[model samples]
Target: MWGSDTDVLNLALAATVAATVAAAGWLAVALARARRAHRRSVDERGWLLERERESAARTAVDEERARIARELHDIVSHKVSLMVVQANAAREVLDAMPQEAEKAMAAVESAGRDTMTELRHLLGLLAPAQDGSEPAPEEAAQLTPQPSLSRLSSLIDRFAFAGLPVEVRISGEPRPLPTGIDTTAYRIVQEALNNALKYGGGRPTEVTVRYADHSLRVEVLNSGPSVLRGDAPAPPQPDGERPDGAGRGLLGLRERVAVYGGDLDARRRLGGGYRVRARIPLERA
Candidate 1:
């Protein structure tokens, strides 16, 4: 009986050991599975983050390209319009008024040169050395300053040379504006005057710049005969669209103004003519 009792106690001890070992093995397998799940979760999160970064980078690049396109359109459209008008005028009076034709040709030359210079500067800004080095001194020197309100007078003169008489009025105290706002303001005037020149039937136009307490307002009013007369030779169209009232120029202008949380109104006046008005809040800018 003593031996049998001893044998039973030994059997119980071995059973307890086996149960403990089985529980430990189960725990080890569960821990390994949890570790693998954690690693997979971490890797998935990392992949999502990387994709987000790439998406943001692509968005930034797209925005920058759009901005460059807008700038190119503004510069080329304004300058080339002036050049075409001058060239046509030159061709018309080439025989009868040789001296006048010479003057018009000179204006054409000047406009062309200005356009080339601006294009070079703009293109230069787009390109950087593949080696990631700074631009050469000569290349840097070729860059020209961007157009701004300070150059409004010259801009108007160019339009005047193209046969669109423009009158400018300034209200309120003139103050220095942020660079972007200044350029935007200048572009607003330019595009408005460009439209007026093309489609205003050579009417007298007015440009008004008002500096309010909190905002800058720009207005361009084409006095009468907003659309080109049927008899008049149609001007060369920009972007293959007839200047018969609407195109990407005004749309681009709206986009530009919207960037600074501004408002732009472009419409035909109730009585006559066309009016383009833009108001940019200085505080938001």
Candidate 2:
């Protein structure tokens, strides 16, 4: 009876050991699968992060390109317009009015020089230093200051010299504005005046700037038959079409104003001319 009991006890012990071994094997397999899944998840996250960085870099580059294009458009369009007008005047009076022709030629030269100066300033700001460092003090000093409302009088004078008479009116106390707002405001007036010069049919233009407690408003109005100087009468275009191809100037202005959370309206007036108005909020700016 004692021998039979010992055999049964040994058999029970063997079964327990076998069950424990099977359980350990299953746990080992599950651990290996879990490790592999974690590794795969980590690799996928790394790839996604890399893709996001690349997308962000591309977006930054596109935005910078757009800004440079806008700057070039504003500088070149306004200055070149003045140069063209002066050149035309010079040519028309070269024989009969030699003195007046000389004066016009001088104006052309001045406008050309001003254009080069501004272009140089813009390009200087864009240029990278040789060692990818900040610009040297001397080099920075050579760059001309950007146009602002303070320079509006000179801007108007240039237009008047080009045969576009401009009258200016200011309401409310003029105060200092943020750099971005000031530059944008000046550009709005500039582009509007340029449009007037090109299409105002030599009619007198008016520029009004109103400063309010919370917002600034600028308006440009010109009575027009919409004819280009020294050329045949321009054909009637579809509404919203400008003579300079697709009205890129106005579109750029809109984009600029939108950046500052401002509203821009450019439309043909009820009676006969074109009007451009922009309202920029100072509080938000």
Candidate 3:
């Protein structure tokens, strides 16, 4: 009996050792896999971070380009529109008023030179070496004498000189307005005139300013039979949706009007013309 018991005890000891060895091997394989997975996760995280950084850099570049384009559009379009108007006027009177045509041609040359100078200066501002780091307050200060409502008479006279018969009428006493509203109002009229010169059939343009208790109203009406021509941009749609290819000036004006919590309406008149109307609040925004 004692010999049999010893054999059984030895067999049990051997089985116990085999089971312990198998358990330890399984644990070692699991630990190695866990380490490898951790390393791979760390590498993927680094790649994702680098990609995000690259995306951010590209976004910043695109935004800067867009801002520069907006500035160019405002400055170049206004100057170019004046030049076009003057050139047309010079051609029309070249035979009748030799001296007046000479003056109109001179105005066109001056406008072209001024626009080039401003474009060069603005391009330089984007150069890193020139400005070093100017993107905010200094820019506004650098752009001097921003157009305003107070300067309406001078603008109208210039258009008149270009042979676009523009008449001005004012209602309610003119008073001080916030700088933003003043600029916006002027741009509204300026853009309307630009459209008239481009698309209206040499119509009589009327600009009216009506000041009220809490808001200011501006309207530019182009009246003539030529407005019915298909060549002209689709007259402002009453649906408030701008038609494609009408030009960006009106679209930009719409954005500015919305910025100040105002309403803008541009549509064909029932009688046969194009009319632009903007109502901007006078109270502080």
Candidate 4:
């Protein structure tokens, strides 16, 4: 009887030890699985962060490109159009007045050269440097003589040469304006005149410049339907206050003016024409 009792006690002890070992093995397996899941989560987070960084870089590049495009468009398109008109005039009068034609031809060449030089200089600045070197003195010269209201006459002269004369009327004193205002004003007039040339069918156009206490007011009005040229987006119809809700060019101008915090009204006249009026508030640089 004593021997049987001893054997039962040893068997019970052995069973408890085996149960302890099995529980420890299960715990180790669970720990290993948990560690693997944590590693995977960390890797996924890293990948997402890398993707986010790349997306931000792409956005910055695109915005910069858009800014560059807007700056060049007004300058290039308006000048080129005037050049075309002048070239046509020069050709038509070539046989009649050789000297007069020569003068016109010289003007055309000068305008073309100036436009190309400025554009080239701008593009060169935009391009990545070929080597770690600064731009030369001659290269810097191209950027000088930036366009402003002072050069407004030259712009008007170009258009007049094209035979689409704009009557310039001014009310109020002229003072030094900020760079942004200067650029915006010129662009508004440039775009308006360009539209007139494209859609006005050589009708008379007027440009009114009014310098107010708070802002610069400019009006470009033409006597014709506000039609756009060849597949170009139509500008805002004369019916509405917003300048660009109707056309691509005005739309671009709207965005530009908004950037400067200005007010613009473009609509059709009941009598017989289209009008673009912009009041650009004067602000500091």
lDDT for each residue of candidate 2 in 113-140, tens digit (9 for 90 to 100): 8889889888876786778898779877
Q: Residue 77 in model 3: shift from native, Å?
A: 2.5
C-alpha local distance difference test of each model: 0.86, 0.85, 0.77, 0.75
TM-scores of the candidates are 0.80, 0.79, 0.63, 0.67
TM-score of 1: 0.80
- Pick the winner on lDDT between candidates 1 and 3: 1
* Cα lDDT, model 3, residue 217: 97
Model 1: lowest-lDDT 10 consecutive positions: 225-234
For candidate 4, what is the TM-score?
0.67
Report the CA-based lDDT of candidate 4 relative to the real structure: 0.75
Decreasing TM-score order of the candidates: 1, 2, 4, 3
lDDT of 4 by residue, 50-99 (tens): 99999999988886787678767766776776677777778988999888
Model 1 CA deviation exceeding 4 Å by range: 1-38, 226-245
Candidate achieving higher TM-score, 2 or 3: 2
Residue pairs of candidate 3 with colliding backbone atoms: none
